[model samples]
Target: MTTSDDEEINPVTMLLLDQKDDDVSQPNNNSNIINIAEVVVPTAVEHQSYHLNSITSTLVIRQLPSQGLSFQLWPAATTFVKLLDSYTPSNTDPFSLTVTNAVTSVNCRQRLRILELGSGTGVVGIAASAILGADVTVTDLPHVLPNIEFNADVNKNVVGTRGGGVHVAALSWGKVEEMEGVGREYDMVIGSDVVYHDHLYEPLIQTLKYLLLGDGDGERVFLMAHLRRWKKESGFFKKAKKWFKVDVVHEDGPSGKSRTGVVVYRFARKDAVFR
Candidate 1:
């Protein structure tokens, strides 16, 4: 699984190659093996390289079957990275400037500890590490860890060059013990495209509650870039309102497509909530 300095590994090709190796060992009588390309939406792993704040980082991503939507590179992830990249500590930009000032002030001697929930392809986390000089941990499901780890490795040099660091881990929503094991608290929690599923709403809220309010550090906030796909997704916000005060920090419909919505929100715990 080692990649050379100039090369980036492709996730889909690696998976198909593994399947082919399996087929060679145990031949199936049924010749109709499913082509992953047809079943998966994107069908291929996209190698995306972004140059932000004079640092370049690359990510390998693929959409796999039955693994939910964690494989592909969504627009929300890209938007989140762009938002992070656009900020500087001296800038008057509201949201990004606020994040930069807060994190930098709190983490003066050491790098800021940032945990990205549902870090598909690890793009946003990697960018945050490289561009912002923060120590970022990218977390997702166990099945998604391999790709996330791979991308982290691929961009390790880039992050290191910027005096930042990256780590990858598996974090399932609503798992209190797992959350406790990962770390006590982070300067910030981030996610993108994680609000689609209706069933995940409550679990996601619980996870946020722990990360933001579980410990005594109520200063922490959840920064998220969400794509408004279905109307039902609004329920996530409604449920989150009970424990968190949510703010739409930024919003835009890219390329003038009014129907396509992308928003960046900041979530902080309510004053009355005592953990």
Candidate 2:
């Protein structure tokens, strides 16, 4: 009689394989388990959203911990900003609707040369361009341009190959005189979620005054989106009114607990000389 040789499988290995096989065979039964496993698995990408200016769109993004990031740009008309007014501060980002509404409210017309200040993710200006059909220039600190440019490139295909404009350049509010080289007075100037720091209030106001066009039959308008903050000392809107006719475009309800107002300010230089 010949001795028969047999291979032995480790119990743990067999159990794992058997489990996997069961998973494959009874897909419906294991669906919940698979979902729970997926949920527990560490994901490289943390989710994010960007407002794209070149096409007037809001882009949803996910940043992979290992790889870089991926984005999908969609028209704001398609993706509405959620109203998270009463949620706990930790659960939401306060600026979403404030910026979206401010951008949507601007009265820009085609060929209404426009400028956006602190164009973070380029949302306000882009929405203005798309809705108002104006050529838009997006300006921010130099460091912020790459993301803005990258987003513009990704969405260019959808917005189209021509007409709307997106130009990126460094524009610290106080440095307006330097940016004069870019040429032309903007018909409309806009900013959103930009005035948090106390030191910035003055410079931000100065930026508006410098960029505003001389009054020529009501062509020049400046719009700002602000949420009331603890940093505000006093007479903030009063000071702003000194330079322009301020209007409260829309105000959030008592539920809007974030310390800012969803405001739209239209500025015209008090001394703007009309032809």
In terms of lDDT, the best-performing candidate is 1
Q: Report the C-alpha lDDT of model 2 over 1-275, residue by residue, as the tens digit.
A: 22222221111111111212221121111111223544854433333444444334444322232322112111221122222122122332323333343334445543546777776566445545544445778787776677667655655543343355667777876665646754446655666556545577788777666666443524455656544433342345566677766655445532122322344444665653322
Overall lDDT per candidate, in order of appearance: 0.70, 0.47
- Name the regions of candidate 2 deviating beyond 4 angstroms: 1-110, 213-218, 231-235, 254-261, 271-275
**lDDT of candidate 1 over 1-275, digit per residue (tens):** 44443332222222121222221132122122345657733333344445565454443333343444576566678678777777766666556754864576564677788899999778889888888788898999898989788878877777887788998888889998878778745888899978866788888998888888775767788889876656556678888998898887788663322245578888887762312
Instruction: Identify the candidate with maximal TM-score.
Output: 1
Worst 10 residues of 2 by lDDT: 8-17
- Candidate 1 Cα errors over 4 Å, as ranges: 1-43, 56-68, 256-258, 272-275
TM for candidate 2 is 0.57
lDDT of 1 at 195: 81
